[model samples]
Target chain A: MAHFEKASSITEWLDQRLAITTVKKVMALEYWIPKNINFLWAMGMVLAFTFALLTISGIFLLMYYQPNVDTAFDSVNYTIMSEVGFGWLWRHIHGVAASVVFLIIYIHMFTGIYYGSYKKGREMIWLSGMLLFVVFSAEAFSGYMLPWGQMSYWAGMVITNLFEGFSPDIAGGIMNAPGLVEWIRGDYVPGQAFLSRFFMLHVLLLPLVIIGLIGLHFAALRIPHVNNQDGEEFDYHEAAKLYKEGKTKESKVIPFQPVFLSKDVFVLGVYLIFFFYLVFYHFNFAMDPVNFDPADGLKTPAHIYPEWYFLWSYEILRPFPKDPGLIAFGFAQVAFFLLPFLDKSDTVAPANRRGLFKYWFWIMIVDMIVLTVMGKLPPQGIWNHIGLVAAVVFIALFVSLPWVTKNENRA
Target chain B: MKNELKILGVVVIFTAILYWGVEPFAHTQMHKHVDGEHFAYSDLNESTKKGNVENGKTLVMGAGACTGCHGIQAVAHKAPMDAATAVSAYGVNPPDLSTAGGLYSEKFLANLIENPAHALKVEHKFDAAKGKMHPMPAFYGAGGDKAQEIADMVAFLKSIAPKEISPKNAYLDACGRCHANRYGKLDQLGETPTFKSETDTLKHKVAVLEYQDKLKAYMGKLPPDLSIIIRARSEHFLETFVENPQSQLEGTSMPRVGLSAEGFEKVKAYLTQTGDPSKTAREAIGPWVLLFTLVFTVLAYLWKKSMWKDH
Candidate 1:
């Protein structure tokens, strides 16, 4: 009962576990972070926090989830509805945490790009980060299928069918292979095979890969440190001086330990509240009832909408004219994987940036927005023309921006 | 160095706790169980009852065994009059017992089932005028005691028969083996036959106003042609044909009718005899074929074991 009676024992325990060693202490809180970093810098921590939250919530959710087609949807419902000794609190936390995870990552990515965080020594970090992004998308999608609802089933159909559009050269002989289709489909249609495979990918294989890759990402981040908004390296001495001088004491940039931990708790609480509201009060939040039915090739759902993340992409292909739009759609989807290559920023900070590539960068953004809108809208005559123009402009800017940025940097 | 040790210590503790205490709780292996939604007709309210149609199912499938040429209960297929097809297929022009008795009375059917010769007198007259009766067997053997059983079966048929027989069922029932295209073959027949349409494919289909005429013509019998196949003759005569056809009729040029229990009942209900019994010497070849198959399987297994003996 008197565990902390002696302060020395507690201090010794803390020192053995959490305290920084002398050598590592030299590269402590004042060593890497920039002094003038803004709220945008908080995005990375938010992203990290989101990942941790998701992992915890995910573990709890996995307790009750069944991953087969016949049971997947019901398992999810049970978790949300009947597994209520815990007030369905864990499920809500997980559901909300997933959306927040995406929200934080999106913010983090845009912050990195806008501030040119992908430059120089940070390239490995950016690459690892991009890989993490891909893994996250895959994890989300596989998780979507585990629910085995109507949206989940049709979404799997829609997304998997996307691979069909790939040229045989790129798609390989897998699709054309005999019995491969049966393997993918499991039965003659989407049933136990698809759900169970997706379940394994979502819960087991993908998560393992994600954990390893995330470790690499963090290691890479440690190599060069977090890139700041101003292109120069952090003036740590000044930051330490300010911290000692009471200036940072009152500043918004708080220490990550206690203060940010509390903030994360608060944000997590907000997310939990919303999650429960949806799970219990509106459990069918992201679901479509029609998706509950088995997939029949004879009947198609009236409208197929991709998950929210792919909405922009889906919108891009919709209004595309038959001939050029097909190619445009291909290029647009391909561009998602090609994003890290498309934006060429040689500097880590915006303050020291110099380039004639800004125009091309703006053009890329405009084109993407246009393409996204085009994909969302139903096909019409003028929209088709706009889509054509958007596609051409997107291709132009996509190719030109990196070249222009690199050239100007060289100059 | 101290900071590094501290960090390493923390990481070790985290991983140790995770791997030991947390992992098992995190990984709760659960399997999916579908909430089955089976519906029972017996459980339904009076207004909503699908009725004891299953009785007809038993008669057609169990005693009748109409599935030989027709498809199984779950799988829909057109059936010929052979045994296996009779149990499975819903029947082309064969009249699905699931809904057949609505058009004809049980007594009327029982009378017909008693004697195919008496019942098919009209069609036989037609055939007689054309030439000789089509070697059709006289089936009415129920005598006096089994008439009510036949009537109950016909009642079951009236509840479930399809309103219309499609060209697919009719073609499959009457001429599937010999013909590929129902429309194509019918066009060549030079008759512009009334049964070639999309609707008149099944024998006891509800939509048919002239189901009796079509069924009589298809069965090669006449109105009130009961011939009591279920009562007079060995039930196995119908049962074997309904369950397995190739055994009952050797080189039997009958179309493969995939008759479901409902279809068999409808046909049975449609066929109960009305006149005196004319006992014809009909042989049941099913037992011989069954015995042959069993011996053959046993011999095949023995041969297989002998082949593997050297190995």
Candidate 2:
């Protein structure tokens, strides 16, 4: 032990002209991480780690994949079914990690929202996190077409076609322009063009924007005090002074030495086991075999669904009748991003709500679940219309939340 | 620590089972095939020649394997090609039989099938331009009633041809798609063959080039590339070959291509050749490829840097 310290001496410091250990501390330390964070709080870490794995796997995929119609499907199959050592595992991991990343991010956001983590002190961080969610979603959307499979082809067709639903005149012009339509198609339809452009966007562009936002999110959050379980902001100086005074007495600081660190490691290990299970055995996670066929623009996939996590949001948007002016759909759809604003009440606890707000919150949750189920099932008539009515009514309730809260506080 | 270790062990075993042990059960969703409904084999007959196209869908579905070579559009089936892998595999033009009746009368198709050589008009502009077209392979080797069956299929195609369009005009329209002024370039309108319109260009190119060897020899001293030869050959030379192949040169091995007088004239006038400009320039080669590579590399590097920078 004496020799171990002696070997790490002045000569090593002199060679660099500064302590080498300082660089390690700067790089490796998570100084901004909340000390009180529990297993639920670890979702962000898991997602971040998964993002890294996805990036690494994505690099390998770019090596052999071809995007053109003739070779696009064949090349992906070659990668998965034939070429490379255990290429199927790589494909499965990349695919599952996509779903997993969204899942974790959603849970993290939900936790943050419920805890009022976006309260004035951390609004910028919350806003950045929300923006990152959208960026990652677009990344997933672009990446979906990279497989050039039946689902990828048709889903891309349906979604890109929605840009037309925004402005028919513009959509018609864009759809008619040989070059523009071809560009949207990745050329002529689900073949090389779609696959190649989507691959570049997925692997490079989306990740860059997401990472930058995530950095800002953390930096902004660091400047404010982290919210505690009791919802009281920590006055760090007062807390530190009290802790030092109590050090001679029976003090309480969760030590990094054994107890909490070991617990975190154990939880992480369990989480990873779940992660690896999905990666290896449940390799078929959400990706359909039929999607292995190249995209034919004329032939839409019989059933179109978004990634599973977005099924709730996609469900909410589905119910509005197409004939209604854009306001109906636009208002219903925009509610998701506007959720942070909608749920703004001084009270974070659900149990304390005196009147309709609590019931409405439960109704919204149920509506979301119903929409999620609807997102998976094929469209039906009267029932689907009823679902849409419910969505509209719930949206109204959500929109009126701030006013309702003000009235209740005055009473 | 012991409880933590036990929890960790359970997690590992659970994960291992979930990852490696789950049985992959096969499930077939009610996926609708793009091709239509099936027909029974018992429905096969001479009368089946007038069969419903909807019922003929089974001929191309799973186990039918018809989709392999024939494209989704059967009448205009062209092999799909990737730009990078198989540029020549899908030729610039393929035959269009959308309006065959206008280009060749029913009797002409019959005689042509029976004897390709006698039916073809031999063109021998010079001895070098005298390569006979390979005899079209018989639909049934050594001949039988398969000829009639093939004729029936041709009739089926003819039935589907749009009522308003002529074969020559349809062929012209197809040709004028990429080469807008193909027929307009023919100086000697009466002497040279040309498409009446752009649509029939593919049909004319295919029919004219069907005599590939003869066409090659005809342009021997001029441009070597077929793409370019169409541009170089004068209206008169092209016209003579279409009008009377054997009469133009003695010892000419060229077979007559039984084109109607109007069809022959239209195709000859329309066939202008041009070479792909990219191949001839040596200096542009390095820089063009390098430019794309640089852009791609720079984009890729920026992407990577941005993605990992935050992490």
Candidate 3:
């Protein structure tokens, strides 16, 4: 047991039992952040804020939403939008947050890669973040099904059909790919059973998993501290001692509280301006026009596409024949998790400092953008050829990452 | 500081490129541009400009025989038979002509009265194998100069229409016969009627089923409910489509209902109301929220500077 002074304040009384003071010191007041980091460091906090917004707004929507296929469309478009007061505000917040969260995640991801944040001891941070991304993707897909609209039905049909690739030929007979698809849907096609199960996953199961992974992500960050722009190392214990001795100017670190938090608050304020602008004025981009129609399994939309966030991977799947395309898509999903091992370079430096690695990084970025652009276009004429080339470049870039960085000089 | 600006510049340029590619360029590729010639209802508009309203009313009530099947509710002209009788006899209930003048383009109305199949663009529906012609007969032979008489009737119908109609009323009058507005709580027969007796309730249910079946048979397939049509289609597509169904979709069972420019606006207003009721409120509050956030951002910047002054 640790010695303590007599209790005088509420914090002291709680500290005796819960060690509340120690927790504050460990997580906030005494936690040291490198002084050299920039505004990109605030992206994690932005993502967390977005997740909180999504959770709150989603709860309000859930109050009026019907999980049954027969009433789902009416419940959203009529009951919530027209009957409930200020219901549209909640929906707009949820819609904008769902979309903007992905934007922040992508920025956060590229920031990590640029600073070599996944090098050595920081692998768990990157891995946990990737897990969160996968779960969030699943959550978005499930939530989209709750609307029971034309796009929702057809996108669900298209995505669920991807499981057919799991079935393979054995002994000159087809395996039960059709059975596997039916099992996931709980029927031969997406229907009442499918809607109910997706509602359960969206509202309950996936959220619980996401919350758990968020905890792990933050925990992973605590151990490695945070990566900085310069990728420089310091003796944190000595830096903290200097910081505490009223020699703040000489210290290489600052406390996570007032010094770091002030910048984060400023960034958050800027981000909220952008966010609410979308929520109030430009919300249509987040909503697909075709989703307004009631779901009819018999009729397919003239063009079926996923939300903008999923476009790059969707493009990868489009350029090849069925089996090879599935393989490419699977590779895209799992490739990021293997990033810590892919770049064999010893030094943890920014891409610009590394010779050939800089070109690799930029080419990879441009290729992804090309893939995203090609994804939304109808795969015909020049677009089909462009998509195929972009997809191939995407695969080749990742496969060549190790070789490109192996011969680079240390920073 | 310089590095941050460089990064910001890169982000801005990247976003601009993505926006251009996904929005403007991709849109042009997906939907081909329709020629302006399709929207020019020229000849019909010319005839309608010269129409005589009094002459139109006399012809509509007397020689036209429109009151036999269709009702002119604004002029107190009722169809001889009720809705149930008409559905049984002709396979679908004929729409009342209370707002036809304002609801349809003048050209569409003239063309429709002259040649029902040609104007409706359902010449395919007149299947010789099925021994079926369109339910309504052409008032005049397909090729003739009955433009003046058609223009006058359109003028009479337009004259009796209310100067300002509610979007809900406009939707019901123009599109309610074939299409249901489920989001607005409207069916083909308008609001569902309440019954005092169980027998009457059962009778209403049976009647609705029979009406739907007959309508399906007449149109080949049931017309899609118009609850979300506003969001599902672009404004340009809807305008050209309503002006002439064949201009967008050839051989469609839908007739050129020919709403005057004003009538189509009202119907579109109703659809927008049902589909996106919060659009006005959302846009109204947008700037205020942005202003508040901007002020907060400025204050936060000042606070950050003060906090970091020592370090």
In lDDT terms, which candidate is top? 3
Rank order (by lDDT, best first):
3, 2, 1
Output the lDDT of residue B114, model 3: 73
Q: Best DockQ goes to which candidate?
A: 3
What is the docking quality class of candidate 2? incorrect
Give the per-residue lDDT of model 3 (tens digit) for B69-115: 88888888887777778887898788888877766776777777777
Q: Which segments of candidate 1 are over 4 A away from where they belong?
A: A1-31, A86-93, A165-188, A235-285, A288-298, A314-345, A351-357, A361-363, A378-391, B1-311
Off by over 4 Å in 2: A1-37, A165-192, A241-264, A323-336, A348-360, A407-411, B1-311
Q: Least accurate stretch of 10 residues (summed lDDT) in model 2 chain A?
A: A248-257
Note the Cα lDDT for every prediction shown. 0.49, 0.50, 0.84
DockQ of each: 0.01, 0.02, 0.69
Say which prediction, candidate 1 or candidate 3, comes out ahead on DockQ. Answer: 3
Angstrom error of the Cα, residue A288, model 1: value is 4.6
Per-residue lDDT of model 2, residues A365-406, tens digit only: 556545555555555665477557666665676678776555
In model 3, the runs with Cα more than 4 Å from the true position are: A1-6, A170-178, A409-411, B35-39, B43-45, B126-132, B141-147, B194-205
The global Cα lDDT (0 to 1) of model 2 is 0.50
Which 10 residues in a row give candidate 1 chain A its minimum summed lDDT?
A250-259
Ranking by TM-score: 3, 2, 1
For model 1, how big is the iRMS in angstroms? 32.9
Q: Is candidate 2 or candidate 3 better by TM-score?
A: 3
